[model samples]
Target chain A: MSVKHALLALLEQEPMYGYQLRAEFEQRTGTTWPLNVGQVYTTLSRLERDGLAQGGGEDTEGHVIYRITDAGRDEVATWFTTPVARTQPPRDELAIKLALAVTVPGVDVATVIQQQRSATMAALQDYTRLKRQATGTARAELAWSLVLDSLVFAAEAEVRWLDHCEARLRRAAAELDVQNSRLTDGTSSVKREFRRSTGETHADRTRR
Target chain B: MTAVLQLTDVVRVHGEAPHEVQALRGVSFAAYAGELVAVMGPSGSGKSTLLTIAGGLDQPTSGAVTVEGVDLARLGQPERARMRRTSIGYVFQGFNLIPALTAAENVALPRELDGVAPRQARAEARQALEEVGIPHLADRFPDDMSGGQQQRVAIARAVVAERRLILADEPTGALDTETGEEILRLLRARCDAGAAGVLVTHEARHAAWADRVVFLRDGVVVDETGADRAETLTEPAAR
Candidate 1:
């Protein structure tokens, strides 16, 4: 999740050309983090300027390669062992929905989940149609194809997960019990059943 | 209390036909080992229904329920009755200590009801008082002590039998904030002692002390998780 550290970590493995590094970054972690050769060069340039890394001159093709310095090694070691706590931006979309759901008559949580699920499913259908239309035989086309597959799979999974979530929420919503025990006999119920076996009446079983 | 004994989906309906009101629909929540869970909801939201059903003081209108893994709904009426007597310790909103009994005697009542030897019950009651940090109040009557002290005595009483499940329906509702916190501390200690408990509270402050907080509405649990689901759990509950 930490992009800077992840790049630095990859660079520590061995000397790599900017293009090679970019490609490897994607191949390794399913790089949702977009990696560009220019970004790799900029980072390597910064690392060389900081003395935490150095350019290994150039290959016969004139592409510069990078190697880590002692300081860079220490930074990568620290990065690997020390966890960076994730700070997600506060998102209260669900909470807002729940709060509003309570205010509207007949708009319980089951209906809410159902509505969300429907929209997500619709989006999945759209994504599937788009995926089917994407074609061609270029490298970019292959990459686009993979991205489309990921998108469609993720959407379908979200729709399925939402369905399961809604079912569980509905099951929980259906089981709210209320406590009220009083009858014409004035015996009350619940505890009265316990009191009855001993022939105790309401007056006799009155708790202090 | 340490952990929840068990709970099943509990639903209850009031009245009949179109006039019928569903108190609880299908509420199911659990208190964990050494966990002090608080169930909070506005009036008419089935808070009491959850505590009572889970405590086995009443059967759910429909659904399975278990206390300490013993199914309350499946047991014969008499066995379920005995389970209530032996496995559950209840502290109601009312102090409800016997007017004539001293604090120690009130604390010992559960054991006495179970036919525990009087001397043994007295010793156990004194120890429970000490556990709740109020052994000095053993001789005092409920009226003699402050409301806070009375609740401590109530907690001592509730745990005297070492019931695995201590179901307190608004145990501190009648007390002021300071006293309420002291009572919460005592309940926390009970959980440390390996008794799992459920505390019903309207106050968010009280509910946050629980390892988990369960929010109910319309006789159902709407949200439940660590007291702080989106933020740090250490943030204290607002009074």
Candidate 2:
């Protein structure tokens, strides 16, 4: 859906051949979201069928040049003004995996967290390195840098969440131990003591 | 590649038996010349402890700490103090600039103490100020400058006399986002110029400036993403 919209938006700029449009898209986005030339042609055909684009003219190289119609311009304007719908969020495999890891017995949750953290951290580093190499201040470079920055921030959040998960797990294990000891001792006094000592809730600790 | 700062299986314990806390437990780390390494962890994860020991501000309870091949554990207090002045530079989150001294004077103080002539130290300070992009503020006192400018002065002081190993502990904590980025840029530039840098920070955005990241947990290294991995990263497709 986005690729179609993105191609439409790019077409709003000027008439372009399939390869040229693909190149422009990749250049602006630093190839982070590479587009196949075939996909570009397919989207262009759909736009033509919808009366939003016309592709009758041929370039010197025999490449069909697709131009946006007035209808296409209107569609692009609507796309710009409208916010992306988030009612049905995309599936996040990492979050799902983490949820499962915590619930499933015999799973080394700490190791899972650590491994994911390292991989995400490595991804963060890669993004940083790419950002460093993208030193140009041109509009295209700015677009690429912003894309890389988004990736870097997302990876950082994932790492921080992993750390928080580890700490929460540790706290839960400690509380479980206290509860187990209380059960063995057959006394309610230790529960009172534990609560008094750890009077601070997770919210309080997070605030700190 | 020679490590400008190396910590070999270092351990540090605070206080005696009953109330003692192990701050660093057998943690080995190295920051090579021309490389910036960021240390990240939750609070009380020995991030600061590792930095202090690396800077020779605090001694490791056991194991070796070598700065430019000089074993800190074998040195006397006076010699180690001299090493801190000559080889290691520390930048704290607070900026820690002396209010009475001008920017150049604050930077020159360490060099002057190390027995550099007054005029020469002053000249070196000016050069360092220029390096941190604050040459025009050389005569301004800490009280007169903005927090960002004061932090620039703090960085100038750290890199003055070409200290081989620069240690920063949340150096941008007091500044705004843009200023923090400028400070990180300065630090990254210093490391790129062949000075080894160890940055202790919790913010991964800040750590992204480093060539590698070392994550600490419970006084031990839990994970590391090294520069080698960074180097092999695939570049974006050609424009």
Candidate 3:
């Protein structure tokens, strides 16, 4: 998410050309977040404009290398020590979909939740398989495994949320049934009505 | 590689007429040697029904289930029971170890039941306990061991006779997260050691250890995906 800081941190190691920087970033991150060479060059130019990095003279091979400036080193140090801000969480499309599905009419909310749950489950499985395959002792493997685990945790959370949504919807429907029966009978026996109609308690409904 | 277990258009129904519950509706599946396939679904989605039919503990109302190329429904009840003891291994959530039996005896029970000599059965059981990384627990009774240790003993029982097909239903339902992971690792190891395994689980994390995942809903196969393509299936669509 913080490509600028990541590039700065990488530059602190040694001077690198655009291609070399991209390759090194990918190697360390296990290609989980691939860096385009063009993106690297563009960032390098911006760092030069901001005086955070300076381009050294071309080598004998005609490749221009960039080195971190004092400003870039200080920025990288701050980035490492500072906690990542959560005040403005990134927009999650699944969260948005579920939120809208509950309020939107004729949306078939159950189907929406089920589809998203299936997708998230598939992704979780993929992450676990990748984790198993990444058994190398290299530092890159460790980094990649950590990244994959975060994704797995996120997907697992999404699936659990979907299940919660389904249970909530079922409860809402059961409550609506109780409200209807109460209005007809002029009796406030919501629990008894729910049981009479569904032949099961709220706990049974949620367990199903 | 050949499939150690195959279900072809299997259909199972409980009760009759208006009260009939169609537990599995024309579901087909296969688990190959050296592969772990996970079956996942909500409750009443036929996961347990599928497992029971595959293990030949129950018969299908329609279609066929084959283990090692032999149709299960074709065999008599006694023959099917024998096949279950010799070719199929089942693990349940309860650990299911006999209270009076030691870990090694529990693991060796299946072999001994199949008329195998007691000494040979005990030797196989010790080897299995060693494979599960708990040989020292062989002499300990189930009550003396931890939940994880008991599960390991159950796994040893499952794989003791070199059974090619292992069916597990919520095998880690009773253990903590770390212990559940250890159990999954053991199941994965068994599959890697050239056995076919089918794991029925509600948790996606448990299903993640599988090579292929099959999703069931309303007693029908809804989706199937290989582990590598899971990301593409879950990725958000273009806004």
Compose the digit string of candidate 3's lDDT tens values, residues A1-208.
8878888888999988888888877876767788887888899999999999999889889999899999999989999999999999899888898898889898999788777776777778778878778778888777777787788878887777787788788889999998898799765677677787888866886899
Candidate maximizing DockQ: 2
Give the TM-score of chain B in candidate 3.
Answer: 0.94
DockQ scores of all models, one per candidate: 0.01, 0.48, 0.37
Q: Which portions of model 3 show Cα errors greater than 4 Å?
A: A48-71, A102-104, A174-208, B1-34, B44-46, B56-66, B69-77, B98-103, B133-150, B174-179, B218-221, B226-239
Lowest lDDT 10-residue stretch of candidate 1 chain B:
B227-236
Interface RMSD (Å) of model 3?
1.8
- Model 3 steric clash pairs: none
Looking at model 1 chain A, which ten-residue stretch has the lowest summed lDDT?
Answer: A176-185
DockQ of 2: 0.48
lDDT value, residue B110 of candidate 3: 90
Q: Candidate 1, after superposition: displacement of residue A121 in Å? A: 32
| Model 1 lDDT, residue B97, Cα | 92
Alpha-carbon DockQ of candidate 3: 0.37
User: TM-score per model for chain B alone?
Assistant: 0.90, 0.94, 0.94
Instruction: List A-chain TM-scores for all predictions.
Output: 0.52, 0.87, 0.84
Per-residue CA lDDT of candidate 1, range A1-208, in tens? Answer: 4555656777788888888878877764344467777777887788788887888789999988787788988989998788666687556675577667756777666667655644554454455444445546665566665775666666556545554665566565555322222434455566667777888766764664
